[model samples]
Target: MGFSVAYETAELISPALQREMIAVTNELSSDRAWLSCEPPLLMNRGGILGGASKPNFSPHPDELAAAKAAGERDGTLSDLIQILCSVSSQFDVDWVISHDCSNGPLGCIRCGRCDPEVQDQCQVLSELAEELGGCDLDLDDL
Candidate 1:
């Protein structure tokens, strides 16, 4: 009889955090083993997840405008929060922020107009879509 392996995979890790990451990967997978690495630094000499990227204001002018406008009216998270607040009626929903600097993900940004009373979620996103400014990142493309 012959034995064969199907595929191989690896994860990117920082030199300092390699051991920790390996331990986590081992805990998760019985077969897959974690390897050591230096975290991929895209632009500068510094590390990722800690570095910031310049927000592209050109690609998302309209969206940005709406976000800013909505943010001004309420805050940056207003549009997304309301949309979420509505869809979440069925279950206990909490905001999950996927923090990826390379992917340009968002956490919550607060505003003045946020109302805990309102149930209409569509209204929130709609108003937000309108108010998007030069770099309304949270909303979809204009």
Candidate 2:
């Protein structure tokens, strides 16, 4: 497919690393057999839906440096929670959960709040707040 179609899919998915993913895709020289087995690395992927759209999938680049920089920045508990929910359904949980931007079909914002400890703490706090008669926190507001 053309870049235009891929870009449209990216827009629809709202991936956290949109610019980076696009850059990686653009850098690709040609289609190869390795694409299926050794796809590019992505810092954060929302999740792919359609088999028909598989060719559009762009792997992420080596992002250790990027992840470190991202870790230094501030992130939100809500983002982590969303990521957790997305990966919980999968049998290969570690692969999906470890990424900084593993959200559901709607995708994540790669906010760097993917730490398990922090997510657990947020869950506890949310539960406590609910038990204490507080109004439910609106997800959209977070």
Candidate 3:
């Protein structure tokens, strides 16, 4: 199934539903297997698959570190990090320069930051940043 459909289905069969199913099954039948089987473990809850898991959906740090170490062992991590660092640095520089030229967040306002020649470049960078994911950095941090 598509991701959204799968996520929605998972959302529907929440922890509450799991508990209800277990309780109802125990009431209707003598089998007590459901009682021993924890809902989280059985359902792979709070996993990469997504569910009524942890508040943070991101991968666990150990998993990420292991993946990065594996990639490093294979030499892929070096190349990937190089490219990512280059791109991220360029984006940071562009964002900072644009914001500085824009003068105090009032936005372009006819400033050279919005000059026709560079407007498209800035817009593309903004779109790229958004695609990368929500940035926690604020103007003050910049």
Clashing residue pairs in all predictions, respectively, total: 18, 5, 0
* Candidate 3 ranges with C-alpha deviation above 4 Å: 1-113, 134-142
TM-score of each: 0.20, 0.20, 0.17
Candidate 3 structure quality by residue, lDDT tens digits, 1-142: 1111011111234465445533542333322111111111123345222121111112234644664565522111122222222322432211111222333332221211233423453344335434433433333233
- What is each predicted model's overall lDDT from 0 to 1? 0.28, 0.31, 0.28
Model 2 spans > 4 angstroms off: 1-16, 19-80, 84-114, 134-142
Candidate 1, TM-score vs. the true structure?
0.20
- The residue-by-residue lDDT of candidate 1 on 34-94, one tens digit each, is 1111111122123221211121212344543564565433222233333333322322222
- Model 1: weakest 10-residue lDDT segment is 1-10
Clashing pairs in 2: 40-59, 40-60, 41-60, 41-61, 42-60
Which lDDT value does model 1 have at 132? 41
Between candidates 1 and 3, the TM-score winner = 1
**Candidate 2's residue-wise lDDT over 72-122, tens digit each?**
221222432443333322212222121222232323223322446445544
